[model samples]
Target: MTPPKLRRLATAGLIAALLAGPMQAAAAQEPLVDHTPGQADIEGGATAQQDTNSLDASLSDAEKTADSVLTVDQMAANQRALASEIGPDGSSLGQGIERLATTGDPQVAPVDADAPTGTAAVSYWRPSGVYGVDVSSHQETVDWRAARNQGSQFAYVKATEATGYINPFFSPQYGGSEAAGMLRGAYHFAIPNVSTGAQQANYFINNGGGWVNDGKTLPPLLDVEYNPYPSLGNSCYNMSAAQMVSWIRDFSNTVVTRTGRLPMIYTTTDWWNTCTGYSTAFADHPLHIANYNNSGAGTLPAGWTGYELWQYTSIGPVVGDWNQWPSTLSALQAFARNNTAPAPSAGSAAITTLAGRTTKLGGATSGVVCGLIGGGCYQNYQRGSIHWTATTGAHATLGAIRTTWAGTGYEKGRLGYPTGPETCGLLGSGCYQNFQRGTIHWTTATGAHATLGAIRTAWAAHGYEKGRLGYPTGAETCGLVGGGCYQNFQRGTIHWTSTTGAHATLGGIRNTWAGTGYENGRLGYPTGPEICGITDGGCYQDYQRGAIHWTTATGAHATLGAIRRAWAGTGYETGSLGFPAGPETCTLVGGGCYQSFQRGAIHWTTATGAHATTGAIRRAWAGTGYENGRLGYPTGPQTCGLVDGGCYQNYQRGAIHWTTATGAHATLGAIRSTWAGTGYERGRLGYPTGPETCANNRCTQTFQGGTLTWTPTTGTRITYK
Candidate 1:
């Protein structure tokens, strides 16, 4: 009888041939293995199992004869007879044999390189040799204990690949290897083209590459090889040999820096030589050489005098890449121990003490240290930094305070160095950090803020910390309108224009300025800060357009644009029109604009420039519907020092005059012509005491000097004094 393995192989071959039919004839001639370079390198080489059934006593007479010369029809008949052997209950005796025949063997065949072939009978661990296996997700479920029992001393389980992929099988394999008393390590499959080498290395170390100084754990390995991504084009990842070398160096250095241990470099001889130009710069690091030809590692790659591990074959009893370590296990353990020794603590006593104080904040003496001002040191922490000096004990700077300090360049910045730790529970529920140059304050309402330079100097003069402005709410920001900068404080804001210098704006005056779009609107930037102690405990601020004036009686008002220029011509706030009582009201009567002041108001229209009307003169103009009335817009400003101690303002069609005795009245048309004829106010008619009264085609005005009348019958009649 044929052996069970050989019999199953024969039956499976027959079934495959019957399924293929005419295609089997063509397929039988082709080689079982494709010896393509990159393609064949993956999962070792291909070795086909031969199907031989020379000895078999169970064959029937007809089947025996047919096996020698089987046609498609005969094969079909045999398949039908075999199918009936599968009963409803389960696989029959014949069907069970067929199931075993189709399943085949699970062992992957080894590459047919010119190496000494070994079976399970051969001892994997020689007295002089150490052995391990490198595995990734492709290995699936592994009996790690069985592998350990087969003389495997160690295992390097793949942890991460590229930048984002993590091996799903890593946890089980790593834990099983360690549980089985085999030394275990983790490795990353390097994909330099996918991301920066440093970033990938950090991801690797953070995931599983980190190693404690345990003698049972091996140093991490970086699996750099031919590009597995052929679809991306180029076996060398489309990079030049020099670039590949730099990428490898960057990855190795980053791994070493992050985890206090140097990583072993794994590569095939040809891959290293071709992709990296056989660079020998990494001579000091350990090498893991892979060579399938198996002529004793087949000429080790450049830079590696001797390799720590050699992947001799892809097919092994452990179901992974088989590796052989030339050194003994103790030497390997020592190598792992030496590379992962803890780093030394910081040298400065102050920094060391600071580290102890800030342990919960992730501060450590082993962190990066830099010189601080006046003979001191500063150490960095995950959340913040600690500055130490003889004068000031080490203090942590974090949160908003740290951000403000960083904006000014930390210790080396304009703030120089921190003088004290942040102090809380200040006025307004705020916190502040003092620096050599200035201070940064923070509150829940305003976040962290900084103030310095000329702006800070001006704020300091106004009592600063104790002033109404209180703590700063924001940093000094520049590039404002008219090439200026401003800083916001709790109660007010300080602005500085090149021409105006530094000044503060507060209360109502500031609000009015803001209503005009601050410095960016028609008013432009503030020419000067708010100046108080004016006409009536009022305040005023000058701007490029005009000025904003505030008083308890008039509130705050902006006087700008055309009406403002007109107001300035009238001696501004110091004149008859004291401080602006109201903002300029535009689109008024007949498209006119007007602004109210302490004395009176200035009104302007397209038809008339701008003119002021005060007291009774303003009242008389209002009675005529102001600019919209028949008198039209004001032609000129109100004029006083008339014939008596009176005032009059000219209009398009009429004029309004005022006196102590005659109040104020408007005189126009024929009544005004008749009054002029009577020598106006200088003549018999002093100033019109009352406006022209008309009835039944007759009009008359009662003046101080005379009464002027007009009629259709009598052209003009004057009752002079």
Candidate 2:
């Protein structure tokens, strides 16, 4: 007949931490635990009895105080004050009594041993990559071999468009994909302008080889995107929720019966969520989601733990043009198997600058424009195409645009605007708009005609848009729905490779055939030749001292300083293992012992401790430094750090001379990261606040103000230095 009790038992340690105030909530909530007492309340009641005793004592005091109170309200106020001292958090005296009722005590209730235990579970998921191809005339040769060679694992070959029409690009690419050993499937970009689902299915079935070899390929996919054409059929873009579902179901079932694989659905994140009410319906089906980002920057569906695959990074360069391509094959397989899903792979991390870190701008201003072949300039808009409706925010400039000259007649060079896609090439042969936006336009004139510069569409994070090539690179490029290279071409000389390092070599010309790792240069020609075997080498080392020099194949040389230098002790003979007696002997003995080096320099301990010639040590250390700073071991020097409120090299300043600890005045440098992370200082000091002094390499004051606080040249200091 007793009311059910809910007693919460908390440990003394837990109580202490609880009173410490809120930090951060755990990642997930704990599961409910059962809390039912099975045994009689002997031990449990003991703690409750103590709380009851305390409550009684307090109540008795309140009663005695009330009995002597001058008025009822005054007595009540006193009672409230007394109750507050003994209450937990904001619990009122009445609330305490109510809570204590279940435990038969007024203090904290004993934790229930039978209460359900709370625990966390992890998500069981994996990611799969999906490869999508938008075939048109360019991919007629669909080389399955090339696709496989490039690591393509699955193919969603274009089948039809919205006019109940088949894309002319599909057959050859499909046949090529088949020939090249790629796992293939067909998809119809739903044509709302055409017939009903049954009619569309019939057209697809008849045109798509009768769906006879279903097992040979993946199930047919539905490529649903924005279908703006309203004339053929209004059904393409607008449909009731029920009608849309029914239509999809019908098309899917038809494909399933014919292909022997379950039909899949491919769509943009927005379309899937808004147009068809598919957010809930498609959860159980294989969905190929598209969110165009250089990395996964697009919105995604909620509760969409797994997807058949994802479309990421579409700006892949191949065959003289950019084609969208999947960043990985594993992501496709995982999606197909219903194991896991991935966001787009068009990674856009924060770019660290001397000014501090910043989020990437949404368009062309965010990318590094590149040059292309056949006498044209290429601009790689970090994202995708520039959507320049007059309403679109645009900054423009007057410039030459290549129409039909020099092959594709597009222009070359960095543009003065930032409106177009990541990459655009221009030719100067025909009439064209002579204006540029969203890029820096650079043009070159040759005799009768000039190469004009044009803006390309922005390169959205992971998405891509194909551009027509008057002259093709002969090789085809493919992308995930959002990832790929937009082919830009003007015929010159062609080589069959995806060497993003350099432009495609033209006609075996030595200048065109750059080698790999050297930023794709013409074959047999030295572009950025790296000399690694030299002493104290810079990325372009050219001289040899404490430093080394690099001579460009183009006949340019650059000098670089030695990364580090160490002196051998006096009394040591050149290349011999002994010490000198005096300073003069120290100079003489260590004359040849000046150890010039770079980071990661090493000397064999087995070798006798002798003063090797400084020249010899310099030579050995040349072009061998791999670390950023001196990480020398064996007795060269300790790590460099701040001393005397300044960065001291090689732990240069001794304890007395160096007044501050290593980290006291030194700062970590900014880093290029996609997410927030720790940074380091590359032997540079933060700006100074005021005049600071040091003598004999020692801090004059207990603190040096100059390097202590980073001050702004501006009147007021900014948020971050």
Candidate 3:
């Protein structure tokens, strides 16, 4: 398919001038009086900002990459400027195809390393695989359903070309393929000498190359080959091997940020060797080698060990260039679904991120440059700077830490550079630097801080950003309680005392410590670090007073006083009970205090002291209405190992006995006196079967062997079972 623009009058004078002239930096003649969403600094570097040339200037998102662009007059002026330059009507995909057709240039590197060319006859003989077609504006109204009938499993539609022109038929061709139940994708034609690779890439994506993980949209393809406009520039577009590699890298990395998948490279081996100087940098990128031949995709370019697809011929089965996917159809569909959509590209990434601050940053000290450690790009300004990576997107770094980083040689510094923005939601409203050596945390209260070594290690142990401490608020401060130093975090604090070294005090344990007046209180400073991995996922931290226990179901709570002693005797968290569920509650019956655990609670009082009541006995006490009921707060811990595997705990008023056979039942008041006379669990009555029940003013307690009946009118009476 040929471009209609080819019919326009040819300028012989302009043709010679453009072909011989060195490429000058192109600028846009657009006003940059304001800011829009994704608009970055001008592509023509500092000169474009000065508006020196009447060329194009990228002022806003609309002017730069978005669909809405240039005023009618400005658009017409740009079209007029390039009126004679739209020479070749062919797509980049067909440059080598036509060249091989006429000149018999070798489609593949000759089997003999010294051979210069090969026959064109075998180049057009189609090879077998799952086939597909590629379309451009030339195939304007494609009957994609007809193409599907022709067994084209996938389709690649030309979305944009050279940063200026978008295929007018891109929508119907791209959409119609999917509508006809075929996989489809978008591709861009390279005019490397015309604009930056990022510019052309952004233009392509904004037009129709944007992808969704719909299992039908293939990875965006980059159609880079011999320059179709030989009258305008040479085959390699005047780019040296290094520049060409950098240009492709810039374009690819930009696409990765926009869509998670690395783009499929569509190029023939001959052009690749000529342009990239046989560079092996892009081995990871999937290759769609264009070697139109009856033989295998021969002598694949430098990097790729295998090809994903082979463009067998430019001659169309219908309306476009047809290619083959050697794998099964399901494999191709799986390929589409595998690369889920990633974060959308912010046009030029770092440049776009730094757009709003262009005025503040002044003019560019250098052009946008990439090929960093992680395929990131950066642009320097008179003040500050902006850096971008696929993982971190784009963020500007300034202030003291940035100055320090810059002084240490930017990315070559000890900490590498800030990977993200100086976000301020951290502890004490601080900021971060996710770097290599150590993070630099800052807060208004403590200026700036960069910590490594032991302090940072302690912070890391507490879970870094997601931990209880969260992001550090300020630098470590040495001084107070037990000659200790402490660093504050978002939610808690890490204290390093001479005695206990460094330990985190946060969450409920910290709250409990606060209640006791912290270090000044009974607990004093931590005696040892918090040790976790006790039974039932519990942790304990020792203090001068006692220790705090923590768990997922129960929060961190301190075990102190007499209740703490009783818990310790029972093996703390590993005892009959588990971690502390809630804080200690006081002012119960007789001014008693109690703290709940995973199993039960430890009740403390002046008379009953403290006793760990758990399991069946505790439930029996609860049934008897706790400390206020017939069976008051437990006076002794539950004791087991008796007849019938029975366990019992003595209360203020009576006792509750339990066995596997008889659940648990409290025998108190008159029943207690009667049961005691018969000897508890050893007499004829045995362990209590169930709780006492009252009806018609008569209360009866059933035992394992007999029944004990009592009432106000009638005294206690025992009946044998």
Candidate 4:
């Protein structure tokens, strides 16, 4: 029989895309097609003889690319790569590796009218081995139970092809078979000329070719057969035997280096011999040969003394390419677990970081595993664990600090990664570690704590350990009133509400706040930092409900509700009425409340609301029993700019008028009204000159313009001064 069955029909449209060379390879990749495999295969793997004349000029396209690495976006690009390399049968590329030993006109052996030439039925006597199947995207969803029912034991799913294309259906196909209790592995299809072998190997591993010590996951495989696209390039992908050998070695070595396992090489006999120059370098790697003869897998590749697996048929009895291992199920599993955890190498920095400290950390309980959120890695130990990232190096965390860190979601938490190791010798024997977010402090009394977010910033601004607030007493406690959070410290506490952010409270302000029940108090939480630039050496911190103004003379007190608003309107501590001197009290007749300030007091009632009374006018109102006597509460602010350089403040009943000569006085009853008939201060009576004198149940007052007298029987009579 002539060896080289002539090349024939291809999916012409698919092959035409290769004319643009590697650019097309790196361009938009096609996703895996979830469909049944097409019917076509030539014995030594040849194409069908139809459409031969039409592909004459197109078959000689020799596309090449620079061997430099690709600056690829692996995450987005790895989803798909349907290439010109896909064969007519879609799953079988071995046909392109068929031996080309023809001398006369190319000829194809005869087979069924519908089947591609050289297709033969399998012999009744099958090879004795653990059988399985290798599927690509074209197989879609394979019925693993059906395949396993056929006595198939394990499966290898195509993971990626070329540096550009990853089998999109990989997760379901690979995981589905495993979930069916079958040992599974991943494979990469090599397009060696497109990019360096190391790059493709990394892409494969990053996509799915990783290995765990689990017996259910098999070692990865490298499928390096013919180009499968003879129309695009030569059979060996436009490379000579020497270049092909170098490419195979690079791919094999990289896979070994990354996974710590020698990958199985799948190829056809004639292609392995012709393309690799029959190199013996990869004899250590298990070989999976592809042959489609009637009796058995035809011949061995040059390097491998014996074959480990076989892809026996493209027209699979079930869904995909049929595979068989010449060993039992247990032996196949044993190969998958070899050289599993190869991280933290003997001389590596991580190992050196833990050199003589195993006593403290205890023996390792887990391997150095990576692929962290920030590219960090960690190895667990009996007592503790060592965490490593490019920026943080390797550091061990254990005990309460580690427990607290774990409680915070580890590296994925608000603290992110640790920037430094735990440092002790702080006040009260406290220890702290700086992280991307903040710090976690631990002490014997406090146990362990984490200070984070705006709360941490407020603490740092105050002086941290040496400030009025010492080390944190506990982790930041959240979910308080109004979605607020607070953290207690050795000396005081810092509070954070969504609307207020964070602020520190210490000394008398804290005392009064604690007395009022802290966050649940009338003041709620502090909305801003304290300011001491007041009239006196006083400071004040504003809170949600009110404020606490502190001064050496008046101490600290909160003025809340309407009373506080009245004080704020009066220019706060810098105004006529100074800082608050006492907590607001509601013990008044008629359910009225009042807050005493440095200079005066502000009173509020259900009927009159809140108003401030200060200076000489306030004393005059106090003499009249304040809100209990004639004038109930001041209705307005103290008004100046009256006649004769005078000032007057209105009240619930009457007004208290003050001036340099008149001092301060109040007007009341009928005799005071008769003075108002003459326009009082602005009219003939002008300003009051003397207090109203009373005797024998009668009262009288002398003003600058006149004197008004009153009796029990008669009202008032005005006598001109």
Best by TM-score: 1
TM per candidate: 0.55, 0.27, 0.37, 0.54
Across residues 1-721, which tens digit of lDDT does each residue of candidate 4 receive? 2134224335444334433344546533421111112221111211323222221212343222311122233212222233443533233334342222112112221233124322335532346777888887767778876886676668888888776677778898886776444678898888765666777788989999877665466787888875554443445554544456666667767888887778888887666665555556677888888876556777686556788887766555566467778877556756666733444432236744663555678876444545556677666666777777887777777788887887786787888777777788987788988778878988898788899889999999998887878888877888898898888998888989878889999998789888898889888889899888777888888888888888888888988888878888899888878888888899897898998888998988878889889898898888888989887777887888999988888888887888889888887778667877888689888888766789998899888877889987877888886
Give the winner by lDDT: 1 or 2: 1
lDDT of 3 by residue, 1-721 (tens): 1111111114444433433322212213331112211212112222223221111211222212221112334323333444355533335455544554444331222244222222224324556667888888767799876887677878988888776787878887876776444678998988765556677788888998977675567899999886655443335553445556767877888898898778889887766755565667777898988775566788887667899888766655565477888877667766766543323444255576565754667665433444455666566565666777776666676676665455444664456656666666864567777665666776665556665545678889977766767766666677777787777777887777666767777776777777877777877777666787887666778887888887777878888889899988888777788777877889798999998988999999999899988988898789878998977889998999989888889999888888888898888888889988998789999888888888998999888789999989788999997
Q: Which pairs clash in model 4?
A: 45-95
Residue 489 C-alpha lDDT in model 1: 87
- Indicate the worst ten consecutive residues by lDDT in candidate 2: 667-676
Query: Where in model 4 is the C-alpha error above 4 Å?
Result: 1-348, 357-359
Q: List the residue pairs that clash in candidate 1.
A: 684-705, 686-705
Total clashing pairs for each candidate = 2, 133, 8, 1
In model 3, the Cα lDDT at residue 537 comes to 68
lDDT value, candidate 2, whole model: 0.32
Candidate No. with top lDDT: 4
Ranking by TM-score: 1, 4, 3, 2
Q: Looking at candidate 2, what is the lDDT of residue 681? A: 29
